[model samples]
Target: MNPLQKRCLILGASTRAAAQSALYAGYHPVCADLFADTDLCTIAERLPLQNYPDNLVEQATSISPISWMYTGALENSPEIIQAISKHHVLWGNNAEVVQAVRNPQKLYQVLKKHDLTALHLREFNHPPPANSRWMLKPKRSAGGREVTVWNREAESYYAESHNKDKLSTDYYFQQRAEGKNYSALYLASATQTVLIGLSAQLVGCHWLNADNFTWCGNVAPVLFSHQPEKHQKLAIQAEKAGNVIAKEFGLRGLFGIDFILETPFLPSSFPQLFPLEVNPRYVASVELFERAFDVSLLKWHIAACESFEQSQQEEFVTTENYSANFSAKAIQGKAILYANCTFTFPLTIERMPNCADIPSYGRLIQKNEPICTVFATGKTIESCQKDLQERSDEIYDALKIKE
Candidate 1:
């Protein structure tokens, strides 16, 4: 694939993160998923869309797809990926490496070999005992879905829901690991690496339903900064784990890692960081940044996918200080990022009336979706968050910001 001639397509671009990265990277970057017009597509405006005929993995992976598709879960997407070979064409990770992290039982053993602590887990084809508390997960899945607490009447229930939807016997049962989860989006090549962005908190927990699938938003970096040193340590561990998996798959592009920060066995000490799994693609954080920064992430990714390295010849640009925020769930159900990037806003402001009167303190003026991602790198996170909220409150309520 000639570096200049190659292109990229990203799966799991439902969120703004992947779209932002691809767009900024300079590729209109194709967006593929079951959900159309997701946040990713709205902002991308022109990213191509692809729908599969059940065998999409084979189709999507059979080429030099610019930057690798950052679809969330590939292991569980077996039907889509049943045709994986020794290597794939379009930019992406090695399928085998993805399978390894998907199997809960296998993952636990792998963790032990790698000197990492993981949840106490097991797999049972038959129903579980009442006192037996194990969290069951699809052998390969993502986004914290179908995870259930230990159940005793497992057999009858299992028979009823066995082949329902994407569920299969290939599923595994384990202890419901509990702890705070976070995401760190990373981009890497054989020789180069960069931590592009990080997300606040992860949602996908279950309490009473025994099955939890929801975005538990707003664990922003602002809140985590209360314990800065500890948070940094965990981020390091997560990046390392993702790197190991990327290396294993012989990967060479953008991806993400999921982790659990929990109290160590030694109670008095700070929480011990543990690497949970790898995403092998772009994540929501980057998508949020794309809108907040108004830079195309896809451009950089495409450059890398085509060349297998960032351009030393051409210069790169980034904001002095910016954020991909979406934490106003307390006030609004969804999130929209309002930011000032190297482009957009100020240039378009003169086009709209009363735009100057509104709080354009560098707040992004575009608001059209469920989540609002904002960027404000003032002296303090509190101040940034406050400014973002004021602008968000005004925009969220105004008819002009409406779709």
Candidate 2:
């Protein structure tokens, strides 16, 4: 380690990009996460975490005296964030803000007061509407991992699992909204916020063989309509809602808001956008924004939280210009490659283009295990989707393991 280089520790379910971003900002990144992929290992010091929150404090203490930041699932566990704060400097929101935004009832009330549309949610005690699909979402969770449709038949099934306790208090049923999923990413300081980018979320992709509501990836610079005017209006609406949430919650650093666009074609229609929840932390779509906009939101995220002397803040451009630029430029997307069946890691990969999150060689991957991430870009969303599909197909073919 260079004596002069600042050291930063990144903790999350996956810290690959956070580590990379730290390095980009000239900091030595130390990472602890579930998968210590080869690419991540190449650039940063990797610490394999057996169990989170329980073991995080000990592991973090082992590498003491370094500032830390969390990426994905850790944001959902404010207690863990608080524990880490006792030993290290946290580079993002404090535990209080995390707790505030994660409280579904409070969040819903706040957003509702601001006229932001959100799904009708209720505690588990409330009976679900008959014949209507409702999703059971775990509080303090991310990556859509245990989120599933609610039903009486699944009660016994859940009762048998270790998550039975979580069902009591940390879970609730939400009325599902019909629409295309979207997310608004932004950077915030104490006083103001800036819209970083927008993404069309990839949910439950058939090619990925993921469950319904499972987050696959994102396509940045989302086009809501063919007409440029409506597209800008939709962007403005989403951004306005995001800014309100950020300011209302006093959210600082890089945060993302998940939403559903019920009417993508008719952007001018009332209640076209319904915000689902606020992820007051670094999200999966940050990588997509960095790729599409040729900007480093992560760098600014750190700067926004800390008192770093950053040169030239990221400009907040007009929504019209933002939408027009996205329409004119290329569209980029990423796909999380999941294993269809249990198999040993391949000794060699063939022509696997734009792949990331690679598991270690000789490691056995179980069914539905996320093997890696694949990325692609093109002139349009459809073409980008096709390109990413092709790349994913090439990887599966090379692996040659059927579902």
Candidate 3:
């Protein structure tokens, strides 16, 4: 596929979801991930620029132009990303925007400055305290890989790895707050940024009934019947963060932000809203929600990528039909771990407009990867969540990972 004709450049581990973005945008996708898959139609490019750590501008010159580029999990620093973003053909999002949300330490500081309450955080490279429980996180990572709560002993092992990685002893520590996790996506250009899509995200909820805290898969258009105020607060907090970030970093293009709601004051009630972490790029679940909502988030993202200076209050340019749907995933094991597990279970998939006799809109049936990605739309958020769960549960229970 020709690079110039493409709408976006996708990185990271998920292909199905990435492909969906490409399809929705009506542009080709130039994929550059750490894996190899034939199903990804576009020509693959280098995963990461080897010699250009600081000067990504030069490295990006190696690839062809894209209407917009959505790449890997961003790091804590934006300088590196800015270097590369300059060379892109389209004016998609730059690196500084991503860096703002990537670093827990930096993000907390800014949130505090903005009069927003964020997670209780601390960063350390050396030993953890004896009685405290904490989560050990990679300075830059995604998909909950190596992000887990560590007891005193577990903290020691992670600290050893951190030392090997040349990590700072005072990396980041946060008082783990209990709350619902949700995300919103926005677009920005050099002069303005706009909120294109608002779907409640689902993650880090597996700990509710687990022996230890486990990161769960994400679903969209939240179904948390328990928390309304917290959810709204988090959304407002996200807008504030984006406002500050767009001005501070001169951020442009497509970006996503994730936050946790905090409210321990009332056990039976939802917790208060608190911004936990921010993701400054396109998120994982955009694929499923876009399908259900009948909106083209990809196009608006492209339009915004053309300019990064847009503000949150700018005129709306995106389109959406419905407000809810569910796309769930399950880690049945490596057997079903083909690609990055775009859609796992609990999805009510349907055939696309023209896909007849197709299995769930001609979804993949080969066990070599995911059996299929289920998608269902509903009139209400609850209806969407309920149908999503029913569909996702049925598929999850029926499929046995063929190990």
Candidate 4:
């Protein structure tokens, strides 16, 4: 460890991406996650947890005082965030902010007030019309876990077997929005919000071994459509929604909004963006944008948190600037390759290029769990996605043979 370098603690399900960003931003990162991947160990100090999330607070207490931040899933546990924040300078949203932003009801109210389209939500007590399509989502979940399309018949069976009232608080129904999924990244200060870039989301990809609404990966610099007018209109809507949500929740630092672009069948109609969920911290797709734009998002995130005012306006990248600088031909993407079968990871995987979140050599990876991430780049979205798929296949083939 460099004595002159400042230490930053990162906690998440996978901290490899954030750790890399921290390194590029000139901070020595101390990380703890579900998997202390081989690549992560090569870059930053790793603290293994006997029981993830449950013992995160205990482990965090053992580290020396330093600034810290959390990534996905942790936002679902505001109490844990609150406990850890007492010991370190938090460089991300506080527990209160996390709670407010994660609350579907609160987010609904904010969108309604702004006259923006929001995902229709139905609590357990109020069942939706049987004909309308809706999805059942867990109240405390991340990465699309436990999310399923709502079926009236299945719901009836569940109601008979379980206590409806008890389950009501834990789950809710959201009207299904059929369209392409996308996420918009942003940086917010006390008074201003800047759009970083937008990415196309990959959900429930069977090829990646992800099932039933599970998040798989992302492709950056996506547009609503090939038409220039339609793309610009959609981008504007996303920017408007981001600014409103950030101001309403007092969100500071980097955050992402996962939304759906409801493209109309009629050419005369413009596509509408339905804001689905808010990830009030550094999201999974941040690295794709970082690669596409060649910028250190963590550096900007920390800067935004430390300085609340709009004095660093010149340094921030807005939606207009992002659109202007983004190349129409270049595309970057990543896919989280999940294990199709349980097996011990080969040591040779540590040397593979363009792969991240690599597990330890000889680590046991169970069926359907993430193995590592594969990256690719090309001149178009199709080529980029194709390259990522080919990379995933190559990795899987290597996993088949014993070292």
Q: What is the C-alpha RMSD of each candidate to the true structure, in Å?
A: 9.8, 3.4, 7.7, 2.7
What does the lDDT read for residue 101 in candidate 4?
A: 90
Question: For residues 1-403, what per-residue lDDT tens digits would candidate 2 score against the true structure?
Answer: 6677788998888889778777767788899888888889988987767875578878988876767889888877788889889889878888999989888888888877888777788897674753447778888667777887776666655667785665677788788777788888887875567776678888888788677778888888776457777677777887788788888788988888888878545655654778777888888887777667665666677767876432333343333223334433468898887888899988666235588888888989998778889999887788888888888888888899745
lDDT of 3 at 6: 49
How high a TM-score does candidate 2 get?
0.89
lDDT of 4 by residue, 184-217 (tens): 9998866578777788898898778888788999
> What is the clash count for each candidate, in the order shown?
44, 0, 44, 0
Judged by lDDT against the true structure, how good is candidate 1? Answer: 0.48
- Using lDDT, give the best candidate's number: 4
lDDT of 3 by residue, 65-158 (tens): 6443555453444554555556555434556446555667777777778787666665564445645455666666555555556576655665
What's the lDDT for residue 215 in model 2? 86
What value does the lDDT take at residue 137 in candidate 3? Answer: 62
Cα lDDT for residue 90, model 4?
95
TM-score for candidate 4: 0.93
Regarding lDDT, does 2 or 3 come out ahead? Answer: 2
Residue 338 C-alpha lDDT in model 1: 32
- The order by descending TM-score is 4, 2, 3, 1
lDDT of 1 by residue, 184-220 (tens): 6666655545565555543532211112433333223
Residue-pair clash count for candidate 4? 0
- TM-score preference between candidates 1 and 4, better one: 4
Instruction: Please give each candidate's TM-score.
Output: 0.62, 0.89, 0.67, 0.93
- Predict model 4's lDDT versus the native: 0.85
